[model samples]
Target: MADAHRPDKDKEQDAVRHPAELVAFSKVKAGDTVIDVWPGKGYWSRLFSPVVGAKGKVYAYVPAEIVDMKSDPMGIAKAFAAEPGYGNIEAISDPLAQQPPPDMQNKFDVVWTFENYHDLHDSFMKGASVDGFNQAVFKLLKPGGYYIIVDHAAAKGQGLKNTEDLHRIEEATVKAEVEKAGFVLDEESKLLASTTDDHTLKVFDPAVKGKTDRFMLRFRKPAK
Candidate 1:
């Protein structure tokens, strides 16, 4: 958690993002292969690299739809991977609507996405099927592998109503969609919940921006 190489700006977010605690809850360890889905700026990937150590691997999965954006997420990931102390990291991308490549199937110990899960339901994703994305995550993990999602929480009973406008999704809605992919809901954490945010404003709204109420869930692929 105190890695000196991490950017000061990224470290400043530790209070709200809780990268250290999230890493521990995810159960990532040395020698475990991890896939970081939609790793904008390689935030989580950077955290995973050192924990996974020399033998372990971290693949930053950049959705094909956003690879060519002005920000060039793929380029950022690739460059970060090449820097000293981050050799274990690699950058990978696939069409948002497609499953992972055959070689990637059942290969990762953990598949993680943070603050971006609701984007899957938004048009910005270019019609990517939420179900298909969940299935792909399921396919990417080895048996008993964990899939972790940390996203802004919507008002109760709203389902997908606020996704596009508010950038949030009902917690139950996410659970239902993911469970449909055959994962078992293993645990959840209130680590990012907020008392001030009323779940009505967009996550980007200045008042609620970084302090939005969020949910963290851990789902496990069955070992059988």
Candidate 2:
């Protein structure tokens, strides 16, 4: 381990893409609360642990629908939260629903669903009403808080028709659905956009896994 007094850059090191921009967009800071919705393996949660420091909290949610998959998604997050340095993070498991938990209402500074928004429409998720889910997310945020979404982009006209097969969604469909939930579209980033992706292959395909064209959207809860 390096010295506790290491330079900020050395302390802030990680392999995730555009970590700086993500932090900027989420507006996360010391003592703020946030959630990494369905945090598959807690990659973002780990990054957030120190940024939020001890006073803040990070909820690494594991949607009840995906818990039984071979990946054992929730196990990974739970183990990570049990580790030495990640005390600031917590593991939360619940079905995706329209109602925010009592303690979470108007409590989060940011609710991030990275590469997992399309799963909201997947078949196995109980109560996975995409619009209602978005509405629930709106309830989870504080006034002026942001709901940041990043997901694989499907073809322009396909909408959600291919979600089960391709595990992707149209960027426009994401925007329109979230807006209907009362969140305002604040910004869209092309940082992960890839014109080379043909949008035909499954997101898990070796040819395109991790390289699918993606969209990053930031939607804000009204301050009042």
Candidate 3:
């Protein structure tokens, strides 16, 4: 069920997010530190900030791989940090694939990426390694932590065939890649599933944009 205790501060930003229950899929509780990977404009970061409350923290990590790509990427994270209710949020950018500092190793309770996981396989994001990225995620998360991924879906078992053109990926590929880093597949959410999507057109197609078929996957670090 969707969390009913949402802060008034998050109502606006959280309303526009699709699936309406993505946060509920996360199961992140108060005082949990969450890492929002590839936080474009910090949308999820904004939503997570108030949920985690003053005792918790949210790290909006802008991948350094794209930091210099003419978009002035860091500007987005900086802007969110300056927002009124974001005191518990930290915007971080480094040369690695959103890896935290040494002092923060094994400190995050959750790490999530939404609508951006396919980009990690894009050729344009050169030198960015998915295995390296997941390994880093494994290192940063404490035992029993969670990693949630929501992204545009490609045809089953199609692998990376459409990653560049359609900006979508086969869910099986994602599972294989992530599980290689030792995370156990915990749960799956069909909240964003769409059968009308033929899985051929680019996610940007006007006909399917904003409603493209998507998959929400949750993986957990084992407690022992």
lDDT of each: 0.90, 0.83, 0.84
lDDT per residue (tens digit) for residues 1-224 in model 1: 78777887788888888887899989899999998988888789999999999999999989888887889989988988787778899998888758778897899899899999998888778888889989988998999999999999999999999989999999999999999999999999998999899999988889998899999999999998
Q: Backbone collision count in every prediction?
A: 0, 0, 0
Instruction: Please rank every candidate by TM-score, starting with the best.
Output: 1, 3, 2
Cα lDDT of model 1 overall?
Answer: 0.90
RMSD (CA, Å), candidate 3 to true, equals: 3.2
**lDDT (Cα, tens digit) per residue for candidate 3, span 1-224:** 14353435446545335524888788777999998988877667877877898899998888788888777778878887777768888988765555557887889899999999999898878778888889889889989999999999999878999999999999999999999999999999887889999999999899888788999999998888
lDDT tens digits by residue: candidate 2, 1-224: 13242235434444335666777777788998989998876667877778888899999988877889888988988987887787889998877774876886998888988888998898878656778778888988999999999999999899999888999999999989999989999988888788899999999999987678989899999998
Relative to the unseen true structure, what is the C-alpha lDDT of residue 20 in candidate 3, on a scale of 0 to 100?
A: 45
TM-score of each prediction = 0.96, 0.89, 0.90
Looking at model 2, which ten-residue stretch has the lowest summed lDDT?
1-10
